[model samples]
Target: MIKTSIQSSASEIKSAREDFFYEQPGSLPGTLSIEEDAPPPVIVLIDYNETHATRKQVSTPEECIPYLDSKSVSWVDVQGLGNEDILQRLGNVFKLHPLLLEDVVNVPQRPKVEDHENQLVIIARMVIPKEHKIGFYSEQVGFVLGKNYLLTVQEEPEHDCFETVRQRIRQNKGTLRKQQADYLLYTLLDSIIDGFFPVLEDYGEVIEDLEEEVVSKPTRKTLEKIYRVRRDLLTLRRAIWPQRDAINSLIRDGSTQISESVRIYLRDCYDHAVQVLDMVETYRELAAGLMDVYLSAVSNRMNEIMKLLTVISSIFIPLTFIAGVYGMNFNTERSPWNMPELNWYWGYPLCLMAMGAIAALLVVFFWRRGWFENYSTIADDTNNKNYGSKINLLWRRSRR
Candidate 1:
């Protein structure tokens, strides 16, 4: 189950590839490249003015036509991109350009802005932190802003960060009810940019926990987490970099669809995007640094192991030499030197005492040199530090 969930999170964080939804080289400019498994479109129409607001789900795109031309600002949110017939009807209902519709239908178009005479097309990428997980889910959101109407098309209906905006509209909070559709666009974009904060915050906490693990007990799993965090941050970087440019274009370009007041709000959104990009870059660098720390920790561990082995070998070398010298046969009857010692009444006892004394002296020498003390110090340090449970908790949280 853990493996499956991890694979799922990886796929979720990896947004649909552009090549999968790209039109053929000579294909028509207006041709759509929808995925085979795209969810059927779900239409939600929200029309409001200063006095009141009304939101309802519409079964057909034609149902939204009546509110588009009304004096009140209308927001038609189309989620999912499966049904070509309904999507085509939605384009016709809003009188969207062929190329505009194609861009909206494409799953992974780069975040950008295109201004038509009557409508402004803004393409954006939205990311939502996965529930109780380490990664995020990303999708494309296209905005078509007109005089008093805004059309938004999303890749899927399951995950979105606009619930707060919807709730604000429902509760009649703030000046949203009185603003035009362009202001609504600004509000939603602000929400999208703000959504990145929670995801980044999660990564920050994960990195902190990882730092502890890397210092105390760096393992292969810790290395894997570092790589994963770096990868996810890169994904976020790719997402926000283009989005910042798109928002800047919205602010700098002279598009009538966006009012000056709304552009001012968009500038704030652009700043938030820039802030998110900075956080992503900072986290990425820290993760890269963690890789180096992990390598050093592993090398230090190996050095400790080798030191222990060297100490044992040093103590045994003299004892092995003494044993080898005694084991040699000099033919005691033929050589007086060997024969006299061999016949001594206490010879075996004296030989044993000499070997024991030699071993004890060697041990004392090593102790005086602080070699033995280091082993005790290392053991004490390892016993005193206790962060294993915390590391496990972090890993469990990330897995979930």
Candidate 2:
């Protein structure tokens, strides 16, 4: 186990060194690590005013330099972190802090908030819904907000929640155009936070369904599903909990770049994060309870089956032994003294009557104990006010 642990840790270190790196603490703040596999940069420039908005996909990050100093609130979006040199040039173009560049290039530093002179670099985690499952595609989002512009660098050129923000800016749909770069950052963060609701809601419904399944007809699959849900909730909790703290810290630690109004929006964002945590924790505990219920239900079922088989054997075993003894011919004709009861006129009738009475008594005993019903139909008896019928079912089925 220790060796396995060592191997896993070594693999993780190798991945880290190979994948991405942020600046060492207090080193040049905007430094970049050019990973060997880093891809060419994809830049998107979105510059907008209260009356109009324009967007463009640029091949080079340097193309965005002219608009950064403009009065319009410009959003320079860089997607993919494959090319280190281009990312560095992009950072220099925006006058991004060395540490900020490092944070962006690192792909996934923890979701955090930091101030770099005139720029506020906010690192956040975003998750896109998985197409085939309940889990999400996690991405690191680095936001560099300045007085006149906001630069966001994403890990890849894939899924993002920025479309809504883009639409709002383009259509002049809401207060987005009236606000500054900080508000735009808030919009994107809020979109990412909102995305979790759908995933969490899926888990919520699954958990509710499991509640019935565990108590009614739990199988090994039910147990496995409960465990997986718990495990995934742990993953989500780990993700959202820190993001919540990050937002709260940002609110508490004021930045000159973030307007007072935008700070209010950030507080709202923090509240949403809290709500996410609450739902995650609630689902986790509920899933745990279902697991316990499943274990108890299975054990109860086994015990019931055993009881039924025991009853059948107990009744039939003695009766069969008596019949077997009577079936034996003890040379009664040769010696009536040896088998006087056999010669009695009503001997056979009396013996048969006695056996019938014993069988009847056993039937009455099983009935009174309510141990002659099918256990497999427990789920059908969900609306039952009492469990007696289900127990009887279990016994009857076991005897069969």
Candidate 3:
């Protein structure tokens, strides 16, 4: 039974290690594919300068053209990529290159940065922890930055991690209004990088809880939780690892679109990415360690069960032998050589008393050998503190 359980756990871990998503093999470059059920695109424009800021929902791609070339910094946010016609029109409005449009449309491209002659393209993944939940919502966010305007594309419009940045911009809480389009880009990227912390905190809390569960009462559910935590951490690592490199490239590579000041801010964002990756790796290692501890705990529990059964069977062996001997019919009336005790009046009671004495002596012998003491403490303080009651119950049963 224990062997079967261990094998099942091993298989589950193996299955959980599979990749989340992958591009179709041999697919052509610059191929645009959209999900059949994807929502239509919605365009929102936020144009701001140092003194004033205005936000409007643009119904058409051409509606954003007047603000795109103005002295004020313009932000064109297009949420959703379901409509190819609208997306192509958007590419025309922003003068986006064909390859860049393809990257923006692809739902799960790897995080990267591409510097064009007049624009900087950034592909980033953003994750937001679900409200009052254990998992996260992940989406791809694309950016196209020109001289005085920034174009942002998102896979979906339902959830985003940019609300705080939006609030800061609306309230004019900081120098966001004073900075250029690059600064706005930095602020959004910083928010996306900061978003990882909350999700990591959630995973950290889960790992701590699983540590206790794995040691004390590791059921199939506990094993599932451990595997899930590891899988989520793996997903996080994939998302953040390339993002760190992208930020590093933004810092090191000379891009005219990103100012020196913005590069300095990008350095800070890079640090946060690195920190998030470190936490992910740490949590993954801890989760793996917990799996090992769980297996060992289960094995120990099985050994204790087998040991108790062995002791019980050993005590019964001599009693069974005595009963068998007494049950054998003896011809005491025909020959004196046969068992004489069978004719004795006290034979039946003596046999019963001897069997009882033998059984008691075996129990005492086992007790003296410290078998009971060892059984009582099979679940140690560090490993199975929550199992004390179970151990006590088993001890009482063995005594009876």
Per TM-score, the best of the predicted structures is: 3
Q: What does the lDDT read for residue 328 in candidate 2?
A: 77
The deviation in Å at residue 324 for candidate 2 is 5.2
In model 1, state the lDDT of residue 192.
90
Q: How many backbone clashes does candidate 1 have?
A: 0
Q: Each model's RMSD to truth, in Å?
A: 6.6, 9.6, 8.4
Using Cα atoms with residue i matched to residue i, what is each candidate's TM-score against the true structure? 0.85, 0.79, 0.87
Clashing pairs in 1: none
Q: Please, what are the lDDT tens digits per residue for candidate 3 over residues 71-172? A: 999999999989998898998998988889998888788899999999999999999999888999889999999999999999889989888877877898
lDDT of 1 by residue, 1-400 (tens): 3563476456546643522256678997899887899999999999998898899999999998888789999999999999999999999998988888998888788888999889989888899999978889988999999888999999999999999999889899999998889899999999898888788878887887787788778888897798778778877887889899999998887688888888888887887887788778877787777777777777777877887888888877887987788778678788678746767799899988887898789789878887754331223254424332333244235324
TM-score, candidate number 2: 0.79
Better of 1 and 2 by lDDT: 1
> lDDT of each prediction vs. the true structure?
0.82, 0.77, 0.83
**Residue-pair clashes per candidate:** 0, 18, 0
- Alpha-carbon lDDT of model 2: 0.77
Question: Which candidate wins on lDDT?
Answer: 3
